[model samples]
Target: MLENGKLQRSLGLWAIVGLGLGYMTPTVMFDTFGIVSKQTNGMVPLAYIIALIVMLFTAISYGKMVRIFPSAGSAYTYTKETMGNYTGFIVGWASLLDYLLLPLVNALIIRLYLESLFPSVPPWIWVVSYVAFVTTINVLSMNSTSNLNGFLVIFSILLIISFIIFASIQLYQGMGTGTLFTMQPIINSNVDMVGVLTGATVLCFSFVGFDAITMYTEEAIDKNTVPKAIFLTVFIGGGIFFTASFFTQTLFPDLSVFQVVDDTLPEIGLYVGGKVFQVFLIAGAFAATTASGLASHSSVSRLLFVMGRNNMLPKKVFGYVHPKFHTPAINVVLVGLVSLFAIGPSLELITAIINFGALIAFTFVNISVIAYFAVGQKRYKTGKDIFSFIIMPLLGAGSTGFLWYFLHADAFIGGIIWLIVGIIYMLYLTRFFRRKLGTLDFDEREDTRAVEADVKVSSQG
Candidate 1:
């Protein structure tokens, strides 16, 4: 329950990490391995390595912002406070696509995996069921969702470990590739830089939730824990993705051999562990996807809550916090309602669109860091400060901007249309920039300050 009309202060380092991993969903490697293998010419692990490096710069920028401004409003808060309210609103509008479409995509993927396992069940039933389940958990409370997320993440990790062990045994027995460790997956004869980079852009989607831990800055028991958790999530999630894809690719080195690329992992399960293990794979996929959907739902609702409270959106609907649960009850339900559109299922095109929003927000996050510290405050005292505040953010902006440059044409066009819609809406909000509305006001609400103090106390004890 709320101590005084504020969201509960209940999460810590591990819980935040769990939520991040749940959002990233290590099973993403399983779902898209075929495409990554095709694009990278079997060097899927190399693609992930490159993606991880690109994500770290942006992650560091997010960590800095969280330390300076620990609020529920993530990129929106950082951009608006430093770059003016208009820029922040645009960045937030771009990020809304990332936050909103994530759960819908997860729900659609969950329906696909379930239908593959049980052909008798209708698709819409699964989508509604998953949406309702995720929304209910989110509405109950933050701790409730975090605890469940931790448990599911543990199970997902164990399942991947099992795959590695079984695959090792098969290699030892002279099956499939006849060797456990081979450079074939990383150093294929058909290696090309263009294919590898395109694959890297696609795999970058796997790292979407690394910044999500910052959304919980207000709720984290120790404010310092948020940054560490972000790094841990990236490295740990990267490690799992790298390991799982390495073994799977080693077992099936040639992409041309498979009839359906998407069915690669399920077939590997059958080969190594029989029909029962295939069933297990299906179950594990569902659990991982559902866990991701739950985390995505939480992040999106929190984003809406912050925007609603700022009067950027309707405060009554988006800003209403449940007195009993201390959660954004109405926003949670609204996200679930929006996720119903996933009933038809369009994975590749929608995924590209989601990545466009993420890249835009990530690029601006780096810019905001530079603008706030280097230009606004002029506080470059030490070598560490100079590198952290200036050099790092510049590299981050360049890296994400490069990715945005190479985004699929369809995705770029769709994102531009979305931005145009947001621009028109911003005109309505600002009265065509005539009123100079939405000027930044840094006052913390009394209840929010109370929750922050309580969280600090909890951390100290």
Candidate 2:
């Protein structure tokens, strides 16, 4: 263990990618299928494609920024370093809506699954138990959390493969579409660009995990490994979503088949396979939720820790890392406590609000790339430099902005209210702009010296 409460650098590229994929929660395609399909008029796969394209561009910008400033603060750090302290605070504050609520989202999902399976039990019981277990795991050690998440992610992928195979067999036997390969799922007479864009806005929630991996940079085996992990996570997660959605959409070309539009995973499972398959599907969904809860819980805690370390939040609590666990115990427990709100809000409402914060962070991260490289460093002279520094991030910003135009009205209201609260808190923290905001210290020389001293003391003893 390192001295002075430093995050242990033990995560390799694959581990980080696993956490990212887990954070994305591959099974979410099924959870949100009915709603997105209804919104897009049965073009769920097209919505995924649109979201994938936009996320890819933003992923590139994230890659470039991580290479420059490899820290746990993610978009907040990038924006702070390039844009300014105040803008970065607002971005970070907005992002909290995404990070903070994700664990609650997972808890709510688990409650839904459990209620479907056992309607007799009170829903809050499941939420509380799930949050407690996930929070406990995260508070113990990040390595254990990563390892468990990796295993669960692999298990969830196998279930997705299983679903695809079963759906394929049914389709070949003259089921919904009677055949797999067709452009009908992508586009039909009901195809509407406006609906597809709206669905894409919601689907943007699915891609937020790729960027969340940037928070693990300080804990990664090497800072350089994080950029590669970010791309791999996005591509891998996107492929799974597109493939699964394509087959599922092809199998059921109309939303009339689903009884409950908001929750479709159980129905999809029962329809494709049988009772047995539905049981397995529920198990996989449970695994997916657990994996996502752990990853998101850990991520939000770290983000809180960074903010606390900079005195943006209460330093004594959020900044406190357990000396033995090397984990943000206080922040973990706090997030878990907040997750108890799962009993209050609906999944659709939470997802809409999450997309709002996610889009905000994505837009700013793309813009930060332009601010840091093109304007701050003046590296937009060469062809390659212009493409890498200017054009690429510009496209990223434009794509995310397009999605913002289609954001849900509830999301705008919720996001604006949250942003206002953040502004008020920021005003108080800086004493009405009289005091300057504190900055994050990314230097590692002090940590290195502390480790060296600990080693010397051990040898002397």
Candidate 3:
């Protein structure tokens, strides 16, 4: 067993998904739709339903992979198992970028919302403060931050629930109401496919980090807990997001939030709670983004650990473990620095680039599940496992792939460039390609000569 250090071992279903997620996700959901209000016609909440289905299917594959392997590398481990190592290395590489800026962006969002609370301080300071503190706390390791995540999630949920109840009150009283989301704005945005995709692209942000729970699967009490946490978080979290959005949209009949343009934060808090919970709303936003940054940092660290261990990356950069803290210290620092730069400027491009990687990861996971079950399931088969793994993943992939076609041209072009760059780097690093995306391995376990060489090296050392 790994020692209790910065790494965690006991995260359950609820804590892993709920708390880490709550630390930063809600605001992403709100902001994405908030920007697309006119496009969604107050039906911005509906976008989450689509995101849920997409994430759920992908989660099925994740849960299956984690249950069988439960390692720290997340998709790196899963892809290696189902596909092979070179593919896994590429995945690990991509995942590094995904989580790297996650914290920085989260910090940035927290800073924006914090301005609502501390009107006097410069917003950038607020942002810097969140990035610093959240990094320090996460660096403290899994236990301390788990507790922090728990409190943040509970508080944020409670406040959101209150907002919902207040909205219900106003609705029941018939104080003021919109026509419950007419479809014109959604069908009619000038941006058309581009607008919807742009709006939905932001919606994708809300769905990105739910998988961070998998990186800690080795530490989880039971493998079953990780998958359950993932699915439930998608459902429950999606519900909270969609419900609040629906009500808030309806509360102000005249605003027409779904028209696909920038709008202020919904007045629902001030309308229903009437400023009593203004501070809480701000806190909820801050906590959500902070959690996002923390989760991002954690995932990136583990992905680097996997790559370095595989010898695909310069191992020494990630090879050192903290003597006392027991965390992957060097890898953590490197990830933070890379993420800080990524977060610094051109965030829209940063976010758009990251989402494409995530979507590609999702697409591959779906394909992996399909490949596993085809002839591979015979290697690891159970009747029930086949249905969820095979059936659900297929459905999830197929559904979300539809959404992918609607993606922004910038995202599409950017994603293509990112993958091409990764491929070129891998050829040089591995000393020329043995094969393409889905058929390479780093473990050396299956290579007769390579395995012998590893054993000889260990003996000589």
Say which candidate scores most in lDDT: 2
The TM-scores, one per candidate, come to: 0.94, 0.95, 0.81
Give the alpha carbon lDDT tens digit for every residue of 153-178 in model 1.
88888888888888898888887678
Q: Per-residue lDDT of 116-204 in model 2, one digit per residue for the tens?
A: 77999998899988998999999888889999999999999999999999998999999888998799988778889999999988888
Model 2 global lDDT (CA atoms, 0 to 1) = 0.89
RMSD of 2: 2.5
Off by over 4 Å in 2: 1-4, 188-190, 444-461
Model 1 earns a TM-score of 0.94
lDDT of 3 by residue, 347-438 (tens): 56667767767776777777677666655766337777667667777786776676777666777787677667887888877668664433
Whole-model lDDT values for every prediction: 0.84, 0.89, 0.62
lDDT (Cα, 0-100) at 420 in candidate 1? 95
